[model samples]
Target chain A: MNLLFAAEEAEEGGSGLVSPVIGVMLWTLIVFGITLIVLWKVAFPRIAEALDKRQRMIEESIDTAEKTKREADELLREYRERLSDARGQADDIVARARRTADAHEQESQAEARTKREEMMDQTRRDIEAETRRAIQQIRSEVADLTVLATEKVTRKSLDSSDQKRLVDEALAELDFAALANEERR
Target chain B: MSQSRKILLGAGGAYLLLVVLAFILFGSAGRQDFVPQEEFELPTWIELGPLDINKAVLYLLISGILTCVTMVYIAKRMEAKPNRIQTAVEVLYGVMRDNITRGNMNDKMAAKWFPFIGALFLFIWFNNLIGFIPLPTGHHHFTVLGLEIPTFGIYAATANVSVPLVLSLLVFFSYTFEGIRAKGVGGYLKSLIPAGVTGAMAGFIFVLELLSNIMRIVSLSVRLFANMLAGHLIILFMAGGLAILLGIAGIGVFLLPIGIALYLFEVGLVATLQAFIFATLSAIYIGGAVAESH
Candidate 1:
């Protein structure tokens, strides 16, 4: 019974606390070596590979995202530049059209003024001609009436030279040139 | 008060009453010697020509199997988006890779030695953690329905000096081999001495460095063995050993709480910490061996 219960029997000398046991050491070596081998062959390689893959995946994802953002920013900048150029072009076109319209208006006003001046000159010339003709006719008619009155008073006919002289005297006495200038004004 | 607070108060009062009752019943018994030696002694279960299979060997086997299986399982199921267990394993993997291996050595060396260091950490960690758990390994037995069953007891393979000594010896040889491989034997030895010393001082320093290099095995082994042995001894005594030796069983009631706290401290911090220290020291030694300067 005492032999079966080994823990109940105390050792005589030391407690054997620091004593080296060859079997235990050998077993430790064997067990640890086996574990290390199994893990090295089966488990560790897979895990290391997976971890490396995951790290690469994360890095690639980050790079792709950064690249996309950079492209988007570049596109936005280009669009803004194009829009600015278009706005400048539109402003230039509007200015050119306004300038052309202004030039056309000035040209039309000058042409209208020239046409009015020509019409006024032509009307003055016509009035001068008509007044002159009326004055000449009046002179002729006066000469005829003077000849009839002279005949009635003296009871005698006059010759061609006498008629001409009487008409020139009547025309001079009447101031027919001044009358024609007043009618033209 | 809150419901949790009320429950806590009730539990505390109950525990106090139980202690008082135990003190009244068993305070006057005659003293008895409950030696701790018996607990640490490894009784052989089987004899094979040159080997004696014992509790320590069993524990080592269990630790090896557990380390292998758990890592393999997690490895097989690993994904880009990890679940809880995979996340935890990844954290441990990072610690081993970045903090232990890569932190100590360059990429080429780290890659070469990561598997060994990782296995060493998991093995030691599992051994330490399982030591705190009570298992049916005690020499004493209980009878029920005419059947005998061994009682539960706490023990650690690392607590036995032989196990850690063997592991330290392995580490010592590994680092020495690496040093010799990286630099020839003469160069490696010469590198051990610090720079800018001459004459007798240089010789003396070289001898001292050689002795210190040899002492690494002892220091590494004893540090782990002593810490584990001390923690288990304290816990055992505080639980009942002291009370039984003093003939005052009731004293254990008071000591049990302290024992519980120590138990938690060992399980929660010391176990993991010892593993980390052992693995980190191994990495440092290996890395130092190949370095241009000591």
Candidate 2:
């Protein structure tokens, strides 16, 4: 009875394996069909959109950065050019100031030279005027002395007219003698 | 003719050819001797303990060769502008690339491992699909090199514990090597202990880390093997019930239709799921190996 039961159990076990296989296969097919449909329609599209959006955002950011960099470069170049222009203007101003200063220095030197020459000429004129005054006074004194000497040389009592004529003649003779002596010395 | 009709005709022709081949090869009375079963009282060639190397090796070789030829031919004939066959291949490639590889490992990493992962997926998928083709049903025998070899009509490579075990070991070693390469051995070992667990607890956590590391190999292999094996076993029982019911009763009432319906669904699901599970686990392992600590 046990042997017969074992044989029957073996047969049933063999047969039982078949139904589960079929059930699993059927379940697999249904699940696979649903998965494929859902994935194709919904999930795939959403994923693709998200990926595209990310790529676009990245590209836009890069482009914006590039544009900003270019603008900065342009501004920097302009600043440099302005700085150079300002330097050039400053150099021009310095050159003009130097030229003006040189001209002023030359004018001042010429004025000083003219003033010195005028002072020297004034001093020489004053010295010459002083010498002429002294020479004139000496000549007048010498004439009076000549008169007295003539009167003593005569050694006689005479009238006034005679004395005067004698004096004049004597003076004239002395003057002529003095002139000749000076010439000889 | 309509496009649908054209597709139907093509499919019908392929099915007829498959049926003819199955009948010619498997229908012979002489082939019964090659199927070695203690229950069936059949003879076989050399046996390795309980494992039949001749049968297993031949099946693997044949399956591998067939897959290689089909894939190579399809690859060569592929065009810039797709024909029907090319479109089919492209669709398969797209699914593997987008969903399996890219979905798990980001784009850059996917690019590195896509070829190997894709090949594995397609090979497993075709092997699983071939089991339902009605050719290699039940047991069969073939003689080669003066040896009688017993074999099944279809053998899911993933279903065999040894195959997944080998694949999982390969993945395990590969990730370990990657970790060591990316970060030195010292760093790799350091990485095993998560951050901020110090003092006496650190030692305990380290032990737990080691256990988890070992468990990765076990879980990867077992997950694939179990899923495939369970699927195959379920399919076997479904088909077998119809056969037994027909033998016992004059008419097989409700068994054939239900069995066939479930069989179809299970095959489709199992093929896709097995492929997905294998690819996902490989990606996870690789990702873990390369990931930086938080």
Candidate 3:
């Protein structure tokens, strides 16, 4: 007890101030010192740590959220780009298929027309050759019939070498190549 | 709050009824010891061993226990988010740390002295508040079979000069130690004399500064002790006067309204304000001590 707490003396006749008791001060110091130590060890440290941890957790969550948002945006952009690329490819394929079909149709038309013209030319040439051959055969048959009639009427034989010459001259008069050219013109 | 608290309140109500019955039976109590007289005079202590413990000491111990229990309970029940008591503790801690410690001192010294100053603030502040409340001790000597039974009660511990002296001495030693540690002993002594002065002027300034430095303990202790003691005395005087007048002329009832209001203001405002002043001043002292330049 300090002078004020010296109740014995102050109560005795003292109006103000009591004898300072050293023991009270010492005990108070001991008790207060224990309190201070406890505060240092427990109260202050715990509070400071809790506050710091909360702050850090908040900041980390904010950072993670931002990162996730950025990554999502990037993915969206990539998907849109791929979608456009696929559309363009589909258009190009359609155009290429149309061009191939048109070229094929034109080529087949030209080939069919050429085949018809070749068939007509072959039919005309065959007709010309048949007509010339029929003409030559008729001429030779007429020469032989006349010779037979002369022989029967006069009762005389014609010379063999002269008869062959006469048949050759008749075949010469019916030219097949000339007649076919004339018909073609 | 809790089921237990409801039960406790119920018990308290029953106890109050018992006290009322006892008061009625005893037929009014004595108010002689409740009055204040001398300026510095308070209560005395009962000597045990070499130490003299008083009513104030017991209350001081109770204040400490209250602080400990509250903090420990909060610590055990602490959550990711603060509950009521935890929030109260944090708010009080924040005020001391940011407002008082950081306000008077720079960042460097604020962190160091915050705990010490804060502890003193809470301890003194609560004790001062509890001091205003007079416990129900029945105020009667009950004799059962020729044995007198007494009750135990607590009051304002900070009003006692010894309590405040112990607190002041802690501040005194802490700052002085920090000052000496910061600047060497010789430099600290030299610092008492101002710069750019010599001879008589320097000596005069040195003596004044030294005296002022020594007076820090007295100012700190006396300021708290006086303020708390003054409030207690004033309330005691009011209570004693009311009791005396009521017993004599029954005129004391009229004073109840003003008396109750003033009492509330003193207990609530004065108690907290004094606590703040004590902590802030303590921080400022340590700040000055450890500062490279004052």
Winner of 2 and 3 under DockQ: 3
**Runs in model 2 lying further than 4 Å from the true structure:** A1-185, B1-53, B106-108, B136-154, B241-252
Compose the digit string of candidate 2's lDDT tens values, residues A1-185.
33356446644654212112222233223333333344334433443344455568789989999999999999999999999999999999999999999999988888888888888788666655654554445444554554555546666555678766765675556544454345335
- Two-way lDDT contest, 1 vs 2, winner: 1
Which of the predicted structures, 1 or 3, would earn the higher DockQ when compared with the native?
1
Task: Evaluate model 3: give its lDDT.
Answer: 0.70
Ranking by TM-score: 1, 3, 2
Is candidate 2 or 3 superior in lDDT?
3
| Per-prediction TM-score | 0.83, 0.48, 0.63
Please give, for residues B1-294, the per-residue lDDT of candidate 3 as tens digits.
Answer: 999999999987876665456556543544333223332333345777556564545666677777665665555565568778778877887898898888877787777788888788877777788777665322335676897763323246677677788788889889889889889997777776766778889888888988988899889888887888767655654543544523421223334445677688888799999888888888888888777654
Candidate 1: stretches off by over 4 Å = A1-16, A66-78, A120-185, B1-18, B25-33, B144-146, B240-250
Docking class of 1: acceptable
lDDT of 1 by residue, A41-109 (tens): 888888888888999999999999999999999999999999999999999999999999999999999
lDDT of each: 0.86, 0.58, 0.70
Chain A TM-score for predicted structure 3: 0.46
Expressed between 0 and 1, the share of native interface contacts present in candidate 3 is 0.31
Q: Mind giving the per-residue lDDT tens digits that candidate 2 earns over B46-134?
A: 55444333333333444555655566566555544567876776677678778777876757777676665665565556555654454
Over 4 Å off, model 3:
A1-23, A69-185, B1-46, B106-108, B136-154, B193-199, B242-251
* TM-score of chain A in every predicted structure: 0.69, 0.58, 0.46
